[model samples]
Target: MGKKDVSISDSIYDRIKERVEGTGFDSVDEYVEYVLREVVEEEEEEEEPYTEEDEEKVKERLRALGYMD
Candidate 1:
């Protein structure tokens, strides 16, 4: 895969550098990539359709809490 360069503010870069100081990440770019991947994965998971069983469970909880009739 090819790589691309994206720019960030110097302060943000320094903050990420400080965050990864004692961790496994070797550079700000690596930590950013890892975080971006996690966020993308979460968004993808959230795109799945909500089914009727899911709706029923939510309704049941709401009813238990007296928010539903």
Candidate 2:
């Protein structure tokens, strides 16, 4: 896929440039793309949604410990 251009604040750009010097990144854009890809992938792995059965189990546990009526 082709890359897209995105704008960021000068301060953030400077920060990325500073880190790029010692890092294996060839440029700030490369580092940003890598970081963004990792973040996007991590976010994609979402947890399953809560269901009524799960809520009922919690209530049962609370009742066993005398925390619920």
Q: Which candidate leads in lDDT? A: 1
Kindly state the number of residue pairs that clash in model 2. Answer: 0
For model 1, residues 20-47, the per-residue Cα lDDT tens digits are 7766678899989987986797689797
How big is the positional error of residue 59 in model 1, measured in Å on the Cα after superposition? 29
TM-score of 2: 0.64
TM-score, every prediction: 0.66, 0.64
Error of 1 at 69 (Å): 41
lDDT of 2 by residue, 1-69 (tens): 897899999999997898677556789999899879856965785475548997698688556534589
